[model samples]
Target: MKKDIDIPEVKNVHVAVVQEKHLEYKTIDWNAYIINNSDTDLETVLIVSQGKSETKITPPMRHTIAKLPARSYAKIEFLQEKVLELNNTFKVTFFEGNKMFDKTYVFRKNTINEKALQTLPLMQLRGVLVK
Candidate 1:
């Protein structure tokens, strides 16, 4: 058997906010800070981050796969908005509680002319710490 290492497993999950600069032909790096920990088992942790819209907030248009330990970042690309185009803007709000967690990461995508790389990899997630 292989030796196991120790790391802080996430229990709760939430997006601090949605952030984007360009919403047109260009691409931008987006990150959803997932607050989580191990449920019962120390080794197994569940982190769920999905893109959807509700009465309170509008979800992301296009996003990569959900949470992954090794790859903790995602990209938001714009194809076309039938009714309402992004035009570089997004928003989030505090919604009710559920099995996952009661948290929100409001975001707006900004218009970017050219392609640019994100400066920071994983920035500190700040907001009301939902416990």
Candidate 2:
């Protein structure tokens, strides 16, 4: 009975980081997002995130999206300059139809910078995407 449940593999879902400019503050900011590229809607979407390294760990932050329509995206959280120095991890879980899917996406330490900017799929904003 333990292995009878079917857990489908997550595909076309990703966590990405992007840079934003605050026109009023005249400063740049970094933010994280979840992208759903599949053709079906995802329900009960939940994302838990944290940052950690050899000697330090940050509190886990959680976010929930009631329903993420196909080929859409949602903002997860804003990334601080200090948090980017640690390895950031996002655990994503959601349901498609009657099946469940789960996946963990991570942004390695120091990897979410301007130099890593690229054309993001679906949402055309330039950012670092975790595939």
Highest-TM-score candidate: 2
lDDT of 2 by residue, 5-94 (tens): 777888999899999987888889998999989998999999999999999999999999999999999999988899999999999999
- TM-score of structure candidate 1: 0.25
lDDT of every model, 2 decimals: 0.31, 0.93
Give the runs in model 1 whose Cα sits over 4 Å from its true position: 1-67, 79-99, 108-118, 123-131
- Candidate 2 wrongly placed segments (more than 4 Å): none
Candidate 1 lDDT by residue in tens digits, 8-126: 32333333332344567365434334333323211222332333333222343433333334324233233233212132232222211222222233333322222322333243432
> What are the clashing pairs of model 2?
none
